[model samples]
Target chain A: MQSIERLVLLGTGLISGSFALALKRARLVKRVVGVGRNIENLERALELGVVDEVSTDAAQAVRGADLVLLGTPVGQMGRLMQQIAPNLPVDCVVTDGGSTKQDVCALFRENLPRHLAMCVPGHPIAGSDLSGASAAQFGLYEGRRVVLTPLPENDLLVVEWVRQLWVSCGATVYEMSAEQHDGIFSAVSHAPHLLSFAYMNSVLDRYNAEQCLDFAASGFRDFTRIAGSHPDMWRDIALANRDSVLGDLKANVAQLNHLIQLLESGRGDELTGFIQRASRARIEWGKPKKG
Target chain B: MQSIERLVLLGTGLISGSFALALKRARLVKRVVGVGRNIENLERALELGVVDEVSTDAAQAVRGADLVLLGTPVGQMGRLMQQIAPNLPVDCVVTDGGSTKQDVCALFRENLPRHLAMCVPGHPIAGSDLSGASAAQFGLYEGRRVVLTPLPENDLLVVEWVRQLWVSCGATVYEMSAEQHDGIFSAVSHAPHLLSFAYMNSVLDRYNAEQCLDFAASGFRDFTRIAGSHPDMWRDIALANRDSVLGDLKANVAQLNHLIQLLESGRGDELTGFIQRASRARIEWGKPKKG
Candidate 1:
């Protein structure tokens, strides 16, 4: 087994910083070097001991690194890949923390060297309402799922090494085709966020129309809390995962309209039953243990 | 000003227990008496220091109390109101912690003594995903909104006393008609829950169809966390506030359909822009406190 002692963490925001913390907490990585656009964020990540050192240059951060974790916004991954491709270590296992896989994997294939069979795309299912380095905490990945989409052409040893990295970080590893992973998350993750954002904005618009802030209550607060998450990151996710997102959006709206029609026809029982079914399922899923 | 030395709290669950803790924390009441259906809950309230004493008898708890808080569900409020009406002191100010006001206020008016003109209908706009006495905590109402809807025929002194009570408990008080208050919350609070519940159920159904449990990530977890809250309580809320919830549901679904159309038609910019707008508004609303 290859020892992932030296790790390069690109982007020290919620996802990257959290990956850093998770790695250290699980004793999976001995040294972490963080690279990001924001110097202050890098300083904060270092100050929190999420990383052993920081660098402004992506190439410098990637040098001699055993594992490189790309946690940038999906839209930015392509540009970063092109910039770091030339300097990437020959045998280094490169992985990403992008939520949307299709685009990031496409960029990795387009930009990286042939030896980049070592490139593994990863998406850890963990986060909070907070963002940036300040919100980064250890144990964020404990018991969380981490999905990996490895190219078929990739060496088995490299794939297992990447899986071992995430497994060591306390994340349960699941492997799927990039297309399958993208479609699933588009329906489950990206689509829900789009709806939440749209639903919250719709409520805000109504409140603004009444010229009253009175409508902002506990329900609205809970419903719209995710709306306060990083906008740029979401925008990138939506755009990169456009096809799946569009399909999911269509299905979601159709579902919502079905509920609306039930309400319009005054079918209280049907609506109530529908909500009850969903509530029961959600309860069975159980609360995600707080870190 | 009427002396508020001892406070008597009915229901002793999340709302009542939190109120008890807030009262004690603020030193607004010298003692708190708890009444509930379950002795265990009452004991839990006592254990949490939310009350000085516990009683299963509603009438016994109400007698000689300067302030009596009815924190039962809206559906049960009328029956409980009838039960304690005769035992309530003529001078004791009667208030409730129920969500829906117009219905609860009417119940109070029809059941309580006509001579006791100090009945106040209040809905403290504060709560959590957890419920029952065990979930109650001190300072739950700190910096939160509490809507007080006073009837036209009610004495001003009664309204002011209720206002003073909540003010002393660390809440900013707002006054509105019972009808208006219900309408506003129906659009914001009740409606959001119904939508969230509906969305979550849809996801669960899809998850079942695909035979995929591993696919549910943090996005699904956060999106449906509230779905795990008390089902009976939510069932009552949906039934009692059906009209407004239905109306808001219609509006929300319409808004969702509008975004879906944009995405389906390949207008990625338009779709992403809407989410960005929603995200910005959410951030503005939930901005972290300034130093």
Candidate 2:
């Protein structure tokens, strides 16, 4: 395929930096400009050779760029899109690495309305608790899944190019509508994060929280692992996907209330059945797929 | 340390089997008799040399035993204590690997009234998702923590004997009241498990359950890891530690309700503060501590 002559990364972090590294190894990009608010992170990106150059200016960095990737948190993407809009090349295919997509699709419509045909919204399913340029690795996306939500007005050619580039990075790309993407992710990802945060806060609210934390072992570790996620990014997600996340959170509260009733009334058999169903389903889900 | 002339394991599983293996390796046990309802697990215990002999009769196995470790679920421990009480040597010291100590203490009081002076209820903080006789390892307790709640009627000599044995197995043991042990474990271990189970069940309740599971990534996997735990064992724990577990569940529900109010009102700054506090605390708790 054709090479990306100039690639501008809006945030020099794990997801975007890894993408840039993988594409460079595939010989798919010529020059990369890493832009971020954090000078240290941008410098690290440069030191690691994740980019040909580093810039503190989003607008200046997007000048003459053929592909502009918005990799900042969802809350900041709209502002970045606005900053780069005036200088963006007319035919540059714009995309974002936002976890929640519908809000991003709206950002494109609001800030880059004229560039809708060249815009694609995507989420790369790769993250540990780690973040920033230091966490970037070329193999991060190998065998990982990327979901792309394309606009109706988007050019088919641009969408296909984006898909092919992700494929070149050893990622399996799947296409879905922005609405579906947000709903599915809220169920599997966003709500769980919010729930973890809620659980952590509850534990902290306890009078013996210090004692509780002191004795926390493996179960608490895994259950609350995501409670340590970046706050601003998650705050944006919770608001952006408000309806679905609210639904799931409400459903969880309902489940907890029902469980309380079981415990209070001493319904051992029903309690066992409830636990058995969930345990069986989780075991089934955890099993290796036959195919 | 005087070697245990005979070591009796009431149930051939991870906790008790590993104890036997560790004691054998330390030359602290001259013989180990594994007793269980499941013949296969007992046979596997013998095959793995976790036991010198296997029996389906708890009473017979406890005959002439100097040390008896109750390793089954707390629900089964009562019946096993009653069975072994008929034949246990007068000087034999009894301990348990029950996760909840208060209930096991009550069980000992009710079933082994004559043996209270020799009873010690314990919990070993070592386990993965794995169980069964094959999951036992001599090194399982290495660098791990064990909590022992000794009955007021217990002899200091017997308690010291138990503590030394665990230290030989490479464990650091702590002493606490059964009430304190139950309260702490309910906070850190039992409640998180039920929350996971409740969350999994909530997801399964959704119409798009399969679709949600299809796209579940790392966050969901870690948050729900304990949901796949053995159902009956967890059921017993929840019931056994009902009061503290109920308090935690209720506290979590209150937290979620407040979170829902925040989400419903669209209080972005307040939401950020909530997440920020949780995020900060979790990050702090997850950091490696220095002496």
* Candidate with the greatest lDDT versus the true structure: 2
- CAPRI classification of candidate 1: acceptable
Model-by-model DockQ, in order: 0.39, 0.87
On TM-score, the leading prediction is 2
lDDT of 1: 0.77
Proportion of true inter-chain contacts also present in candidate 2? 0.85
Q: What is candidate 1's lDDT per residue for B17-76, written digit by digit as tens?
A: 888787677667788898888888888888878888999888878888888888887877
**Model 2 lDDT per residue over B1-291, tens place:** 889999999989999999999999999999999999899988999999999999999988888999999999999998888888889899999999989998999999999999898998899988579999999999999988999999999999999999999999999999999888888888888989999999999999888899889889999999999999998999999999999999989988988998899999999999999999999999999999677
TM-score on 0 to 1 scale for chain A of candidate 2: 0.98
lDDT string, candidate 2, A1-291, tens digits: 988999999998999999999999999999999999899988889999999999999999998899998988999998998898899999999988899998999999999999899999999988679999989899999988999999999999999999999999999999998888888889889999998999898888888889889889889999999999999989999999999899999999999999999999999999999999999999999998676
Please report the candidate that would top DockQ against the real structure. Answer: 2
Residue-wise lDDT of candidate 1 within A1-291, one digit each (tens)?
Answer: 456678888887777888778777776778999888899988988898988999988877787888888888787888878777888888888889888888877888788858557888888888577778878877777777888998876778888988886787778999998888887787677877887887777677664434233447555666677777677788778778888787666666666677667656766577667767877777766745445
Query: Using alpha carbons, what is the TM-score of model 2?
Result: 0.99
What class would a CAPRI assessor give candidate 2's docking? high
lDDT of 2 at B238: 97
